[model samples]
Target: MDATQQEILERLNASGKGTVLEALDISVVEATKEKVVASMPISSKHLQLVGYLHGGVSVVLAETVASLASVMNIDTARQMAFGLEINANHLRPKRDGQLFAVATPIHMGRTTHVWDVRISDEKEKLICISRCTVAVVDRPPDDGDPLFKK
Candidate 1:
């Protein structure tokens, strides 16, 4: 990875503290202009009562990486990306392994961005495929909100 990608990954990992990403143990492994990759371990925390990875967990992973990719493509000082819609299709079930999600942009417009995220097991077998649409809105002046404060 280049310097900028490393910086982006660092910032992403840092920002996950105390968030769902941290709770789910999601980590960004690669980031670039074209794609962003994240991984989560399929531990008990991520499984449902049926002993399989919960569908919600897969959706969360998809949205997180897709939103991150959209944010990476925009100027953070001036804009913010918010997920507008997301859909996921689970193809396979995973019990105990690492899941990797890769997000690639499908459409990058001035007001919106769309991304396709594919989640796979450690062996590279597709587990889920997701698409997310993110809205890019101008950032309002920070009013001491911790989320908006740099």
Candidate 2:
């Protein structure tokens, strides 16, 4: 990766501090204008009662990478990207190891973005496929709510 790509990856990873991303130990391992990739360890914290990876956690990783990719495509100073919708089809069950999610843009529009995210295991086995729609809108004026402001 080039310096710019490394910087983007670091920034994206740092932005997750104190959030669920940090709690889940998710980190952006690759990033570019067209795609973003992240990985999360499948620890006990991420398992269901039967010791399988929780489906919702897959969605979280999917949206997180896709939304981060969307942010990289826009000007954060004036624009914001929000997940409008996401659909995931879980194809396999994972018990341990790491889950890697790669998100690529399907459509990049002025008002919205559609991303295709494929989640796979360390062995490159497909686990889930997700398509996420992100809404791009003007950032609202700072009204003191950090949630909206950021």
Candidate 3:
């Protein structure tokens, strides 16, 4: 990881958001300038009544991983990353197993970044895939403001 990426990762690791994400067994495995890989375990809450994973859960997980990747490159006050778009394709069903979501940078430009995220099982078969776009923008100052928590 580069210095800037490391700094952002440090901030995220110490931030409140990371703490909550961890409680859900979600974490980033690879974080760098143009790439990020996050993993999450599938649980009962993530499944449908038939015991298969819900489509929405996969989409949320994919979006979260891609967004976190973008956030790692954002400055807390000066700039932030927001999702511009997200698209996911579900290829198969995951009955019961630990699934991982990997996000790879597809495109990184001056104003936007795109990530390709894949959800896979222990067998390495892709269960779902997502393409996410995040827009980099100048963020307003926190200034001890309650609107955006510290």
Candidate 4:
């Protein structure tokens, strides 16, 4: 990882609004200015009722990868980026083996950021594709919420 990439991952590890991918042990396979790749093994813990990888799991992986991209976009500015919208479509169901996701930035601007996330399996077959938009804010949205847990 380059100095800038390492700096971004450092902040992501310290972030509070963490990914659901953590439960699956998603590993960062590649990280660069061009694209980011993350992977995880498909195990029973990640499966649903029929012994197939849960569709929701794929969505989480896609979103998490995109979230990482968004975080990297704002690390230098110390700004918070929160997903404003996400659209996902599942093309295939992954039953076993490993799943990987690649996230690339479509647009990175001052106020809004967009990312294209593609999730595939061991054979490099597309399982899910998603688009996420994050809004860059000066502070987290919890500003007006109660300090105590609800």
Clash number for each model: 0, 0, 0, 0
Local accuracy by lDDT, each model: 0.90, 0.90, 0.74, 0.75
- Which residue runs does candidate 2 get wrong by more than 4 Å? 1-3, 142-150
7-88 in candidate 3: lDDT tens per residue?
5555555452545466556666666656666667888877899999889888877877787777656654576677889898
**How well is each residue in 29-113 modelled by candidate 2, as lDDT tens digits?**
9988798999999999999999999999999999999998888888776788899999999999999999999999999999999
Error of 2 at 9 (Å): 1.2
lDDT per residue as tens, model 4, 63-121: 77776677666654446667788888989887789988999999988988889999988
- For all predicted structures, in order, the TM-scores are 0.92, 0.91, 0.78, 0.78
Backbone clashes in model 3, listed as residue pairs: none
Worst 10 residues of 4 by lDDT: 141-150
Name the top TM-score candidate.
Answer: 1
Reference-based TM-score, model 4: 0.78
Order the candidates by lDDT, highest first — what do you get? 1, 2, 4, 3
Write candidate 1's Cα lDDT for 1-150 as tens digits: 234766778878888899999999999999877999999999999999989999999999999999889877887777888999999999998899999999999999999999999999999999999999999998898633222347
Worst 10 residues of 2 by lDDT: 141-150
lDDT of predicted model 4 = 0.75
- Among residues 3 or more apart in sequence or in different chains, the pairs in candidate 1 whose N, CA or C atoms overlap within 3 Å are none
